[model samples]
Target: MSLLSDPTRLAGLVTREVRTGSRDGVPTRIAVARRSYQTDPADLWDALTNPERIPRWFLPISGRLEVGGRYQLEGHANGVIERCDAPKALAATWEWDGKVSWMEVGLTPVNDGTQLELTHEVPFEPEMWGRFGPGAVGVGWDLTLAGLGSYLSSGEAVDPKEGQHVHRTPEGRVFIRASVTGWGEAAIADGDEPATAQTAADAAYSFYTTEPDSRPES
Candidate 1:
């Protein structure tokens, strides 16, 4: 069963399932189509590949974007560029522990705007992944997509730490709460018992909402 059985785990703003697979005893899967407001493929591509433009919307990144070139985010691990196609597609190896996770971003021009798709394929280890719940990865992607969309639309950066606590605002909090519930439903749909998923969802939400500075029993 998918490890996203908890509602709190599923709290990302956008997550579209694309495909799932397994390779060499490692489980690998894909999800595509995230958020981006820019309708022009070239614009979207620049926002993603240009290191200078990336930090304006997403996290700070420093790297050579050419194929087979290595790159790194200021606070993220370094990885090699696996594919690079101007105004259309980009893929790379996301480095972690001498191993690499696969990530791809695709841009497609649509009627209203450009559709941005992000696919990530990593070795799924239930023990580690389950600890954070599905929302761990999902919410992060949602925030990333939102940042990209905002940047493309108004050239504004969505800095969560910049005294504008989006996650704490009423709208932001509601969206997050609903996303957690949706994840709970998804968990049940994925074959987990309803009661178990619900219980896990509550626990996950508490973990996320708790103040980071609060201390537990020693």
Candidate 2:
């Protein structure tokens, strides 16, 4: 099977959880995506926090990268570093498009490798939720995780353009659709309506797999 067709190779390795929570008196939801990587906690943490190395796998980051400091991820979100702890956990404010969200990454030592769990919390906006379930974020994390895996295992940088090209093909659509469905079920388990979540999942799948428009806006 092609790499895209093989479920074990490029498919969603992240397990998801949706938790009902409250933020600033507004009912919100926290979507948690968890996955294990074939690297030790220290190496994984360094790959994540080290400014010099992050650009190799993820995006170029420029910021203080300290507690109560500020950070920017390339042409993406810029936020303050709410909390930072070495080789364990980090939390930050994800400020983009004039809105703010919370993001946290926790690392755990499991056997020989490390387990990474990313939790993103946002205020529940029905319209946005109608457009996509957690997969909108979940799939993005999956992409990052895939890149991290490639880098950690082979010491090679994943071409974002080439990776995206594959994700735009038919085989990529199959993987994306499965990711959306998985997130939809996760949302339902967190108390979302069945039909509504499915509709949003379909929209999310289409939004991610479509060429050009599917890519994240700068």
Stretches of model 2 off by over 4 angstroms after superposition: 1-9, 212-218
Worst 10 residues of 1 by lDDT: 1-10
Cα lDDT of all candidates, in order?
0.61, 0.81
List where candidate 1 sits over 4 angstroms from the true fold. 1-15, 29-33, 36-38, 96-99, 163-171, 182-218
What tens digits encode model 2's per-residue C-alpha lDDT throughout 47-142?
A: 999998897778889988899989999988999999888889999998988989899999999986999999999888877876787877777776
* Model 2: ten consecutive residues of lowest lDDT: 1-10
Global fold similarity of model 1 (TM-score): 0.75
Q: RMSD to the native, candidate 1?
A: 6.5
Which residue pairs of candidate 1 clash? 7-180, 7-184, 9-135
- Tens digits of per-residue lDDT, candidate 1, 68-121, equal 888987766789998888888888887865776788888888877788888776
**Residue 108 lDDT, candidate 2, scale 0-100:** 98
